[model samples]
Target: MSNEHTTITESLAKVATRANELCNTVDAQIDNIKNTLKAEQDALQAKKTQFDAQAASSISQYQGKMDDFIESGDNRYQKALSKGDVIVPVNLKHLDDSKFYPVTLYHCKMLDVRVERYVHDDVSGGGILDYFVQLQNWSNGGDFTFAKQFHHSYSGRAFVGKISAASTPYTSSIWLRGGWSYKFYLNGHYSKGPVVIESETQVVERIASTDYFLAPITEVQPHVAANNFILGV
Candidate 1:
């Protein structure tokens, strides 16, 4: 009887040991599955990062190409066709008296405008344009406006509010730089209003980059007047 009891006890102990080993094996399998899932997740995250970087680089390249295409000469010429052209008179310094008519136009703001004249290289044998000056109107920045008129020296008559489309619109790289071979970059003002200007074959005198009359011109500009005499704002 004692021997039989001992055998039963031993058998029970062996069964418990087997159960413990199976539990350990199951735990190890679970751990391996967890590790495999984590590795797969990390791989997926790396792929996403790579995809995002590649998309950004592709977008940047497209943007650069679009900018270049917009700035191309052909693009500008098309835009100019819509904005029109500015025709500069062949004889700017000396105009016929008929061009200057009495004008009593008034405005609160007149901005300064600058222009420089140079020779036009007309490959054609027509020397008539050899001395023609191209008027470049660079649109000015800031709202600082002044008073004065685009005057004709010969007639001593000042005029305003006349941007004729007869030739084209006055333009430059400053306000615009697309259209025609005429390119002028200047900082100055014209009266505030809807006035277009185009000067081709235009001319203006210059005392180098410095001019003596600039002070006097500015002083006269502030001399606000309705009759072109002496008045104040």
Candidate 2:
């Protein structure tokens, strides 16, 4: 009886050991499947990030190119007065009035004029100099009005502005787009009056981003010295 009982106990131990071995093998397989899925997910995420970065770069590059194209087109289409050439529009009635409730030129295009000046003179036998940037709106089978609505500009002018109001003599020359700000004066003397309405670096009003472009002007002193700065037209 003792021998039989011992034999039965040994058989049961073997069965339990075999079951444990099978369970461990199954667990290992499950771990392998989990690791494989995780690696695949990580690879997909990396590819997505790379693709998104490339797409963003492409968009930025194209946007810059488009802007350049617009600027170049505007330069050619707008009829501006060349150096040493005195020009005026022939059709006076079609011209828009300068100053007070300024209107946008036809076709949603604005006449951009920039102006800056520095001059000095004594209160005796005096001399004064003025500078200006003049532009004309060429007929596109319609509007023939010139853009003269700026500082020290007249009825036939479309775009103009005063550049500086500093008390110093300055040489007259083309003041390009740099170190300048547009000040819309609301009131009195000495550069800008007592009240300055608004100051801006650029006046960018357009039909979307690809239409009109603006530019600046000018002049002399009372024992005069001044630099009135503006960008307009």
Q: lDDT scores for all predictions? A: 0.33, 0.35
**Where is model 2 more than 4 Å wrong at Cα?**
74-233
TM-score of 1: 0.31
Report the Cα lDDT for candidate 1.
0.33
TM-score of each: 0.31, 0.30
Runs of candidate 1 with Cα error greater than 4 angstroms are 73-233
Each model's number of backbone clashes?
18, 32
Model 2 TM: 0.30
lDDT by residue (1-233, candidate 1, tens digit) is 99999999999999999999999999999999999999999999999999999999999999989897887967754343233243222222223222321111112222222222223322232111111111223222223322233321211122221221111122211111111122222222333222222333222112347321100011123222223232222
